[model samples]
Target chain A: MSLIQFFNVTKQYPPNITALDDVSVKIDKGEFVFLVGPSGAGKTTFIRLLFREEVPNRGQIIIGGRSISRLKRKEVPLLRRNIGIVFQDFRLLPDRTVFENVAFALRVVETHPREIKPRVEKALAQVGLSNRARMFPHQLSGGEQQRAAIARAIVNNPGILVADEPTGNLDPATSGDIMKLLEEINRLGTTVIMATHAWDIVNSMRKRVIALQHGRLVRDDREGGYGYEA
Target chain B: MKLRTAGYFFRQAALSLWRNVWMSLAAAASVAISMFLLGAFLLLVFNVNHIANNLQSNVEIAAFLQVDVPRQVSLHIQDQVRALPGVTEVTLVPKEEGLQQLSQQFGSEQDLLAATGGVNPLPDYLRVRVADPQSIQSVAEAIKAIPGVEKVNYGQEVVERLFAVVRWLRWLGVGIIAMLGLGALSLIVLTIRLAVYSRRREINIMKYVGATDWFIRWPFFLEGLWLGLFGSGVAALAVYLGYRLVLNMVGPAAVFVPLIRDQGLLLWSTLGLVAGGSLVGALGSLFSIRRFLKV
Candidate 1:
C-alpha cells in the first residue's frame, strides 16, 4: 500500500514566491526514493509538508491514508512519531551524551524507563556508536554526530525516515558510508525519502528519483540518474 | 503524571540549579533580601498597631463637676454618663479622693506638692471608660452638655496624634512590601530567562525531535520552582532570626509593643514568602519560555 501521497500540492509563500507548485507524487511502503533538485527547488518544503510543519497552500497530503493537511496541533506529534527526520546540521542535543540523545525520543513518548535502556543500546549499536554512548555531541566527529542524529531518529522504529541533505556536510567517503547505512535501514521495510543535491550519489544508488524545478515536479524515473546538469 | 515521575523533573531542576550555582545564588540572595525587608516592615507595623490600640484602651474621658454642686447631682452625672452608648464604666472621684490619689502619685517628690497642698484645689470628677476608644470625642462632647459640668478632658489630641503615626506606618509598610514583591518578581524573571537562553540549543534540538510542548517546558518550570522555594525559605529563616534578635535586644518591656508575640502571623508570613517565591519563579519561567515554544 502507498505510505505517502501528495496530490496537487502547491505551497506559496507571500506575494509571489511559490516553494512547491502542483507537485503530486506517491511512494509505496518500504520504497526508497531520492528527491533530486537544485538549491531553492522546494525539497525541504516537501519534507516539511509530510511533518505538517508547513501546510500546503492548496491540495492535500495523505500519510498512511490519513489526510495530514488538516491535522490539528495536538495530532501533529502523533504524525511525527510515524515519520523520523534527519537534518544536515546533525541536530543532536549538546548537553546529552550519545546514548541519552538517542533515548530522548522514547522518553518523550513516555515509554517505560526499564525498556528505554535496551532500546537505546540497540539503536546506538546499529549506528556503530555503542562504544561512544558516553561521549557528548561536541566530542564527536561530524560524521559521528550525523550518525548519532540518525540513531535518535530511528530509535522509535518510525515507519518513514525523511532525510534532508543528510550527507551535505560530509566528505564523499563519509557520505557514501551514511548512504549505505540508510540503505540497510530501508532493507528492514522502512520507507526512505532522501532530499539531496549530490548528483554522483544519486547516479550510484540506481534508485527511483523524483526531480523538482521551480517548485514543480519536472521528472519522475525508475532507476534514474540525477536529472540536474551542472 | 505520577508523583514519582514529577519528582524526576524536580531532581532535574535541582541539578540544573546546582550546575548554575553562581547565578542561582545571585537570584536567591535577591529574593532573600527583598523578603526579609518586607517581613521586617510587616512585623513592625503589626506591633506598632497593637501598641497603639493597647494605649488607646487605657485612655478615658474625665468630666469635672462644678465645685458648688450637690453631692447627689454629682452622683446623678456619673450614672448618666455610664448609661450613654459605648460607656463601659464610670467612677466618681470626689474632691478629697482625687487629692489623695494625686498626692500618692507625687509622694516621692515632696517638692511637687509642698506649694499646692492647703485645701485641695482639684475639683471632683467622673472618670468614664467607653466600649470604644474611638468614640472619645463624641462621649466627651456629650458629657460637656450635661448641666453643672465645669470641664471635660478626654485627651483627644494625644489619641489623634498616635492614630496618625499608625496610619503613616501602615501606608509606608504597604509601599515597601509592594516594592519588594516587584523587585523579587523581576529578578526571578531575569534569572530564569538567562537559564533558558543558555539552553537554547537543547531547546532547538528538542523542538525538532518531536518532543511535545509540555515536555520541553517542564524542566525550566521545575528550575524556577527550585530557585523560588530555596530563596524564600532562606529569607523566612533570616526574618525569624532577626525577630528573635530584636526581641532579645529590646527586652520583655517591649511586650507592650508585642513585636513577635503573634507566632501564627509570622508562620503564615513565612509560608507566604515561600509560596510567593515559587509562584514568581514559575511565572518568570513561563514568560521566558512562551516565545521559544511557539509552533
Candidate 2:
C-alpha cells in the first residue's frame, strides 16, 4: 500500500508563477525515492507541500492515509512531528553542541528528559557522530555538520524522512558516505524521499527515481538511473 | 506544564538573554528611564494634589457684620449662618479684636493703622467653615442672606482659579503618564522584535521540528518579563530613595506646606509601577514574536 499519494496537485506563486502544476505520484512505505531535476524543477516545492509548509492550489496530498491540504493551523505542528526534514544548509543552533542539537528536537516536543538522552545518543551513533557530540556546529566539518543535522532530524523517530539536497555541499566521498547513511536509515523500514541534483550519486544508487521539469513530472521509473548528464 | 518543562523554559530564556547581554541591558535601561520618569511625575502629581487639598480645606468665609448691629444681633446672625447646610462652624470676631489682630499682622507697619486716630474701623465678622470646599460658594451666599451681615468674602475669584488650575494640572499629568507608558511599551516591543529577528533561524528550525507556538514563545516572554522587572525594579528603588531624600530636605524647611509624607502610599505606588512595567514587558514580547510565529 502507498504511504504517500499526490492526486493532481498544483501550486502557484504570486504574479502568475506556477511552481508545480498537475503533478501526481505515489510511494509505498519503506521505499527510497530520489527526486531528480534541474534547479527550477519544483523539487523543493514538492518537499514543501509534502511537509504542509505550503498548501496546494488544487487537488489533494495524502500521507499515511490522511489528507493534509486542509489541516488546521493548530494541527500543523502535530502533522510535522510525523515527518523529519533535512536541508542543504544544515540548520543547527550555532551556540549549541551536537548532542544538544539532537536533543533539541525531543526537548521541543516535551519528551521525557530521561528518554531524550538515550534517543539522541542512538541517533548520533546511527549517523556515525557519537564521538563528535561535544563539538559545536562551527567547530565541525561540513560533512560532520550535515551528519549532526541528520541526527537531529531522526531523533524523534519520524516515519518519513524528507531531505532536500542533503549532500549538495559535500565532497563526492563525503556525499557517498551520507548516501550510505540514508540507505541504512531507509533499510530500517522508514520511507525516505530525497531531492538532489547529483547525477552520479543518483545513477549509482539504483533507487526509484521521479523526474520533474518546469513544474511538471516528466518521468518516473522503478530502479531508474540518472538520465541527465553532468 | 510540568515543572521540568517550566525549568527548561526559564533556562532557555536566561541563556538567550545571556547570549544577547548587550541588547538585553539596553532594553532594560530604556525601561528603567521611562519608569523612572513615570514614578517622578506620579510623586509630583500626588504631592501637588495633597497641597491643593490642604489649601482647600483651610478655606473659610469671613462675613463682616454691619457697623450699627449690636453684639446680640451679631451673635444671632452668627447662629443663622452656622445653621445653614454645609456650614460646619462659625466663630464671632469682635471689631476690637479684629483691629488688634490687624495691628499685630502689620508688625513694623502698625502705625499705618494709627491713621484711624484711635477709632476702630474694622467690622466684627463671623468666620464660617464649610463641610465641603466645593460648597463654599453656596454657603457664603447663604451667609450673605442673613440679616445684619455686611459682606460675605471668601476670596471666591482666587479660590476658583486655584481649583481650575489644579484640575487642568491633573489632566495634564494623566496625559503625560499615558504617553510615557506608551513610550515604554513600544520600546519593549522594539527590543523584543530585535531579539526575535536575531533568532529567526532557530525559530524556523523549531517550527520545522514540530514545536508548538507557545514552546517557542515562552523564552521570549520570559526575556521580556526580566527586562521589565529589572528596569522597573531599579526605577522603584530610585523613586523611593529620591522621595526619601526630598522629604528630608523639605521637611524641616517647609513645615507648614503639607507634603505627602505617607510611606505606605509611596511603597504601594512603587510596587504597582513595578508590576505594571512587568506586564507591559511581557505583552511587548508577545507582540514582537507574533510575526515570527507565522513560520
Best by lDDT: 2
Clashing pairs in 2: none
Please provide, for model 1 over A90-197, each residue's C-alpha lDDT reduced to its tens digit, 9 standing for 90 to 100. Answer: 988878899998988887767789999999998898889999999999999889999999999999889999899999999999999899999999999889999999
Cα lDDT of model 2 by residue, B146-258, tens digit: 87888988867776776777788778878877887788788778878877888898889999999989989998999899999999999999999999998888877766777
Return the clash pairs for model 1, or none: none
DockQ list for all candidates:
0.37, 0.63
Going through the candidates in order, the fraction of native interface contacts each one reproduces equals: 0.33, 0.77
Off by over 4 Å in 2: A5-9, A22-27, A57-62, A65-72, A138-141, A203-206, A216-230, B62-128, B135-152, B157-198
In terms of lDDT, the poorest run of 10 residues in model 1 chain B is: B108-117
